[model samples]
Target: MTSKHSLRNPKDMQYAFSYFYYLIHKKVPFDLDKLWAKEIDINRDGYLNENELRTLAINVFSTPLKPTTFKEFKSDLYKTCMELRHPTPAPVIVEESSSSDSSDSSSSSSESSEDSGSTAAVPVIPATQTATATAVATATATVTATTAPKATTPAVDNNTLEVGQKELEACRIDLEVLKASNKTLMEIHKSYAKRTMYRTSIEGTDEVAFLMVDDNDNSTQTKLDGVRQRRHKFICLNDNINHDKPTAHLVIKVIHDFYESLFPFPSSFELPPGQTNHFRYIHEIIDKKQEENNKNNTFIYIFGVVGVMIVMLMWKRSKRSSNGNHHSINGIIGGVGNKSAAKQRSNKRYMIV
Candidate 1:
């Protein structure tokens, strides 16, 4: 949870947590090293750089990562490696220089002195030089003491380095083996994905055949015959055809006969024919429903047309009745005017008489 690596992106933290969770609790059989080599190592380089690691997360772990997240992951991994190699001290102790380094320096100085004839005897000197001679003798003793621990220090360091290198090499070897195994497994998976007609596994070998025929095609029967003759250990027949095609019924019948020929007798636990006719019944029901829908649509169209015609007839009748009423009223007014004119003529004859 607490990491020295400063990850800027929160998604990166999530990615790390997901990966750690898988490492902690997943019980499924998976080869991480092999999956890494096969899927992530696109360039076939042994090292898993950031890009390769991203690929591994996406393909194997099913974890999608952004660029920033992957960068954080790289940094976190580096931090972990450093921590493993040299763990952080509980109580930090600052030192000006390391004792081992000082020891090494002193030892080198001593060796140089020995090479320059450090053991040569000192010449006899007067009492006046006695003080100086005493000082030189004291410095020599201090150097010898400092150089004493030098030998052990270099030896310890060499041993540690050697052990580390050996362990690293062993780890590399194990990683290579895992990669090889993963590659094999991936190949097996790919073969299965391709649906190979024949496949051989580590435990056993078997032959398989698959045929997908368009039921309406003329070559359907020929392909079925070939399948029957092959007699493979495994055979898969795919009925690929348009369900609404006119020849659908005939094709289904032929396929049914082919299956019946292959398996003449029913197994003891097999369902009865009537019980197994559920899909057929469903298809029949669907067909009847479709017919009903078509009939309903036809009736609706006819009713709409008849309704429009009736409305037009009613409108025409109303218009004709209004026009006839107007003409009859005009004729009655003209007849009244004609009778008044006759009365005026009779009055004019009486005046003349």
Candidate 2:
């Protein structure tokens, strides 16, 4: 959400949020330190102050930001960048090489002292030769021991260098990924910014007012008056009305009256009274069509009733004709039977004679 007093330009706000979201998710593309130094840390002082960041924002977004907005943005950027950064590992402490060197020297001195004591013993021809040989061997062993390689600071330094090289290689890989991500981000920003222009209005100065009034609110007129007094370049009025309420019509009337008060002049599209109200013309047309449909339905019902009555009359006539035909057929058969019976009676009379 953006405030009118802060970064009100929608394009600028959109980009700001996109950048901030990337930071929050640790996907900020560029190395934060590099970005800060290159873009925000003016004077190359290794620290980003308010002025430097504000200048960067204006240059990048092509719009000035409110102080409060800049401060909030800076704080969020600082926090997110800090969270994304990896802490430097502490150096490993190697025990002193000097300590080991001192121990070796003490041992070598003890061996030399033992060899010197053997040399100090009384001389016998064979004993002297054995003592001299033993002393010479001990002296040679001591000299070789003294000259042997001792643990030095350079060896410790080499181990430290290897660990550092590993860390440096890891950092280089991360930096490469970030650089690629940063390049892609820059391209996107350039294309998007070119396609969509940012608003150039001054911060904290708004030319539009948006007012929303509920049907139950009694101070709607007061709000309207305030908007009128401001004489804004544009004004939008929104109503929150419960259409199911009985007083909805009254609220609608109040809204209509307010519009009339604001725009009393006639437009070319408006029709005079008694002529068709274009605003309600659609409703009129719908009502006329409904009435015509009702008349058509009535005619269809009457025609159906007449057709049913005619069919019933034809059915009754057909049934009567069938009954008359059946009666005639029965009378003819009775007449034939009566004649045959009379003939049989006559034949019987003849036989008796």
Candidate 3:
């Protein structure tokens, strides 16, 4: 609201509303000074006033903000203002001393508008003006004094307190809607992560998976973005799994390959110092392969040992038999040398060649 400055920026209203949200969130109450600093919402150095405030509330309170964009916020504002102009009377309960008064109130409301009110089964307000309504909410003493300032606004009819209560209820509804929407968006992100994850057995890129190294010298080995290590999502299609998504699969594969090229795993992987979970997932896959290889090597070693032991046993047995036969033949030659006369008679009869 700085004297307009001859610069017509309609988006100013949008920025003001966002700051209004920021301040209210900090639990810092608003006043004129805050507007000067541009921390508070202003329509030329005054609080957006009750009317404008209500308009803002309606937009903020209605259908959930998807992505919470400025455009969405402005759209909500317009919608709320339109709705405030024509309010539907909710079926409200008011402890009344008499039934006739209630009838008079209902008749007045019907006559005031042509729409016949909505049949949405809303709660009805018992009091028509704010003064009496304040009396019920507070103690018995302050109703008359409080009702004076409210006389200017028509919404502060005989059931001013009731109307205030209704406004409060609307505000509560808006709060609930925002909270629920935030939860929904968070859930959607998680769902997206699970379906497109390259967490297991894919081998390289998603194999060792992707990593990110920021200026802080911190490394993220499992995800492309350091911030979302738990659930990283990319668009990929598996033609083998789904026939219609071949193109989708091709697009994703290209991205995966490109990402892997950027953050290839070195011979040794240590996901910096602090990145435990991502490191752990990669480590698990690596550890499984190592364990399998170790098991195979161990089996080979055991077999080689057994084969060597059997060969050694056979060689020892053959050497022992050869030595025994050689000793027996030598013993026969020594005994025959002493019997020469018998040997000569044997040679004559046999005609030795």
Candidate 4:
């Protein structure tokens, strides 16, 4: 059976008493009820009174009383029990009639005492009422003090205000100057973009595209159509030029140098012997000859030789026929010469006869 001073269940009461006892003494006692009766039960009537129950509640919910589990349930139970057992204090009301009567009697007594030239007797207020009044006055003063606005410092002087305005104006001037500078810088950037061109990478090739900037500072990118020549120029001129890669500027320089080397100015202008070997003309002629050699075929050479022999044989036959005709004419003339000699000899014989 639970004791009259205990909670609803004997086990819970024992635990509660033991918990509170440990909180107060910092050690669990052998008998929780004996400790509770000795320390908490002020009247020792074997029952917990209002004060004892409030004390027990405070101990149970004290800051150091940290329960490891069921913390929410313990807090709720504690709050519920505290609300049931220790309700809020009701508002105190003094009788207006009694207060007015006391004030009037005090005033009359003070007037009589003052007329008699005696020290005005002090009004004897009850100790409890005086304490309550003092407490109420203190609370009212604290509330008013907290809610009231703090006294501010005096307004800034004219000199300080003038100085601050001057500083603000200087800052505004600086900001305007910065804005103007920024505008000028943007204009310079626009001009630079219009004058400059960029070379960007091309996909699936080691080649790059040249992006030309227009008058409006807009870019137009185009892939180099003749990449082979440009690549050759890049290989040849990369060592001589400062650029690491082929750009429009570098390509232009290469083309200019190549043209100058091929058809120099003044028509008779010649490069130094050392620089002449770097020109492409010699390399181009050598490459053409190599290409022709690579394209040469045995059958074509044989056909050319046969055609040359046939033409030579036809020329020889025509020459031999003409020679034979000339020799026959000469023999006929010799025969005529023999006949003329005979006719001359016969004339001589006739002359002799």
- Write model 4 residue lDDT over 1-353, tens digit each, in one string: 24454335534456545655545444232343454446545666554433554454444444453433223322333333333443444434433454445556655765676686746555555557656655665665566556554444222222212122333233222112312334323432343333212333324434442333222211111222243345432221222232444354655554555456544654456655556444456788698778787668666888899999999999999999999999999999999999999999999999999
TM-score of each: 0.26, 0.24, 0.21, 0.18
State which candidate has the highest TM-score.
1
Summarize candidate 1's per-residue lDDT along 1-353 as a digit string, tens digits.
Answer: 22544534544465555665655554434445554556656777665544555564454324555655544434434333434444444433334234444445555665666676847653434445555545555666666555443232121121112123333333332234333444434643443233333333432223556777685645777777776887666666765778888888777777777789889999997888778534445789798889999999999999999999999999999999999999999999999999999999999999999
lDDT of 3 by residue, 1-353 (tens): 32454453664555555665554444333232332335224345332334444444344344453433433443343334324443444333443434445456565664554355664444545445544644454442344344334333233222113223345334322322322345323432343333321232322344233332322211222233432343344323222223255344544454456456645674455456456553446678799889999999999999999999999999999999999999999998877876887888888989965
Mind sharing the TM-score for model 1? 0.26
Clashes of each: 0, 0, 21, 0
Q: Rate the local accuracy (lDDT) of all candidates.
A: 0.57, 0.58, 0.46, 0.47
Cα-based lDDT at residue 159, candidate 1: 17
Q: Where does the lowest 10-residue lDDT sum fall in candidate 2?
A: 153-162
Evaluate candidate 1 by giving its C-alpha RMSD to the native, one decimal.
Answer: 22.9
Better by TM-score, candidate 4 or 1:
1
On the 0 to 100 scale, the lDDT of residue 43 in model 2 is 75
RMSD, every candidate, angstroms: 22.9, 18.9, 28.4, 44.8
lDDT (Cα, 0-100) at 348 in candidate 4: 100
List residue ranges in candidate 4 displaced over 4 A.
1-217, 221-295, 298-303
Show where candidate 1 strays beyond 4 Å: 1-92, 97-279
lDDT of candidate 1 at residue 284, scale 0 to 100? 91
